[model samples]
Target: MAHSAFNRKESRGAHQRLDEGCTERDDVNFLKHTLAFYNPEGAPHLEYSDVKITKSAPAKRVYGGEATAQDKQNKEKANADDMKHVKMEVMRYNPETDDAPHFVTYDVPYDEQTSLLDALGYIKDNLAPDLSYRWSCRMAICGSCGMMVNRVPKLACKTFMRDYPNGVRIEALGNFPVERDLVVDMTHFIESLEAIKPYILGNDRKPSEGPNKQTPAQMAKYHQFSGCINCGLCYAACPQFGLNPEFIGPAAITLAQRYNTDSRDHGAKERMPQLNSENGVWSCTFVGYCSEVCPKHVDPAAAIQQGKAASAQDFVIAMLKPR
Candidate 1:
């Protein structure tokens, strides 16, 4: 990679060292790419692939390229009085090219409305085209942009850049495999959610039957727990989940409690067996960080604590019953 890049003779992006003077893009000679072929017991061989251009003639890019022009514009605009600067340290990784994750700092322009997601977008658009991350529903409702800013789990959309006076160091959410950059593999979290049967179960009643109404007191029992958006922030916040990926996790356990406490849901008896398992609610030590990081005030830690009490009482009742 070093040899290939050094051979470019250009003074920008990958071609860091320029023994030759800077010049506009010369597509005539530079249109081809270098390819390396590995050999078993000898030095690798180099080959070149010519790029075929069938369209209109290529335009000469002065002072780097269009990327450099846009970057210069952004930098100049950032110098205005109303604009402010936010230093963003974003973690980057690519399984194909990178051996491990590494942090890359970017100076971004921000105002009162700029968020962590916005900073990332600016970096991707104007600075680095290869930057990878996840985001949707710019509002916090979609829960797709969860990440760790300064070692604390948060939703990038909801977290404003102005709050971090010093700067923000962003990484992928904890306790999950990095899919790419800020994106994580939430398959385990999805499986855990599915294991608890998140939906109302065995409700085969016909529409003719009256509504299974619940009083306000009954609604209050599970209302707070029902607020979970399945953002996985609680799972990231949980130290136990970090240690054991096999654990059902805070969001799933809290979901179990949500349905178990609901007057409409009759799946509690079915859910208890899973909750009583080795990788169930008992894994939680009530660290309460799950509740602290919950974007919707789901309070998963409280639900898990309640589940422990329920588990104990169920055990006692089962032991005393005449069998």
Candidate 2:
């Protein structure tokens, strides 16, 4: 797997190759699964299999264009005719009224371009005013509207209703206690984030001691991990956190890795105790689901795995040097 990844000289998704420096997707050579056969004595044999493209064909994205009035009307009418009403099963709970959480169905008027957040807003405005869910900024930046949509962790604002034309089940994020309808308790997540100390701890340098400047190379080391918005979608998708709530799940660990990699940060030693703990990098089984579900593409799985290697090296060095 390592060999295959190294040889793939194209940038795609979260995998960016500095040597290649190409942003365009290379569909011809890499749009397929790479199967590696293990060998005890020799280099592993590699094979490629075609990816099954079921629903839509691959196409380049065209940005910045508004649909014409006629096009908008046509699409709206088509959507209304095709899907008059969409049955949304939203999880509802209230400590005052209900003892247990239950799914409350709502038949909402479907629109083609409308997002899942929009549908929820419609229900809140017209149908059920008492229904509770956390949302702010309506954009994907806030990361507050993250929920289990069709059993996958995604931002409701980013997920369009047209994608799931049939229907979709909405619930609170997994691996968390439900505070109320579609609102999971984020106390644990917040605490974990705080423990990581997700800030630049410079070398005791004050603001008066000139600027803590960094070159492009220094920034690139931790830039990707810094994009995390603390959505907790990674926690929802992490099996390790599900099995052990005490585990310092993906996002926090990723943030730790982020700061550790930064050239300006000097708090890696302080954070090492948590990273090398039993409930830290060691607990992660590397399911890679955390990376798959991250809207920001923070790639927490990669960060944890890298932390494991670094921690192991540090442990071996400490043992040898009696430090």
Candidate 3:
């Protein structure tokens, strides 16, 4: 701008100051000042005119320099006023160094769009280098950011910071051993899922039995159960699992039912032993908190109830038919 201007007033050899309220610097305020024009013999002169002359409605002449300074101050104040800060109370744990887990609080600024996961990231990046947690596919698809927020199970990325006007309390998912700060050991969970035989049972087809057919209605029977992302929020919310870790848990039972209700699967018989065991579907007292906390809305409580009915039917069939 200084290079292309006719002759910037600040750099002019001999320029007459005909305008008022011109400061030492920022007098122009990026093209808001009265423009300079060249007179005869190429000598640059400041155009004598009211600042209001270029305004949408012309009436007043004001101090350009003072107005520019005041406007900058007001903008700075407004930007500061718009932002709000919250305290993130994050759980910290180190098995080798600490006897037990503890909480660390950090003051982080946030707006309505700020998520709890983002707040944790901010703290980890700026405040504490040793902070540890887990997150991936921040859109909530990967189910890796599972944690206990304010004592409730949720995905950090999906949980917003602004929602907690009074701040937030975070911990690892319940019913699982904490591996680190927010990461819980999922070995038991993985084994539980494997125990259910969560795949379709083969019918011993030589080639292909025309790829088992099913209409939309048949698919709809277990469609809701198939949406499980295996976030394990349901397991965290289940009081049954907390009471008895041996319980197969909601996610595993729901997965079992997902295949059991499928028209293309014959693995229900194989899964029935696990589902009918003392630690299987029978362990769930149907508190329904598991369904309430499931991020994907895979209703494990409903699935367990369905499994009970199936188990009862199996009992009746065994009684009716002599082995």
Ordered by lDDT, highest first, the candidates read: 2, 1, 3
> After superposing candidate 1, which stretches have Cα over 4 Å from the reference?
1-82
After superposition, which runs of candidate 2 have C-alpha atoms over 4 Å from their true positions? 1-83
Worst 10 residues of 1 by lDDT: 8-17
Clash tally for model 2: 0
Q: Can you write out model 1's per-residue Cα lDDT over 1-323, one digit (the tens) per residue?
A: 22555434432333332445535555555666775555665665666767787978789766544566656666656653467887889999998989999999988888788888888877887789988888889888888999998999999999999898688899999999998899999999999999999988867767789777789999999999888888899989899998988999998998999989887777888999889999998888888999999999888888999999999988899999999
TM of each candidate vs. truth: 0.74, 0.73, 0.73
Better of 2 and 3 by lDDT: 2
Candidate 3 per-residue C-alpha lDDT over 1-323 given as tens digits, one digit per residue, 9 for 90 to 100: 12247556544422434375444444334334445666767766665332333446666876756577457656545653677988778999998798999998888777888788878876775678788888989998999999999999999999998798788889998889998888899998999999999887965654555666699999999999998998989989988889899888999999999999998888788989998899988898989998888888788899999999999998788789977
Score candidate 3 by TM-score against the native: 0.73
Model 3 regions lying over 4 Å from their true place: 1-82, 204-211
Candidate 2 per-residue C-alpha lDDT over 1-323 given as tens digits, one digit per residue, 9 for 90 to 100: 33656445332333555466746655656566775665676676666777776787689775557556567557655655776578899999997888998998898777677889988987886679888888898888999999999899999999988887688899999999998899889998999899988887857888999998999999998888898989999999988899999998999999999999999999998888989998889999989999999998788988998899889987888789954
User: Which candidate has the top score in TM-score?
Assistant: 1
**Model 3: colliding residue pairs:** none
lDDT of 3 at 278: 93
lDDT of each: 0.84, 0.85, 0.83
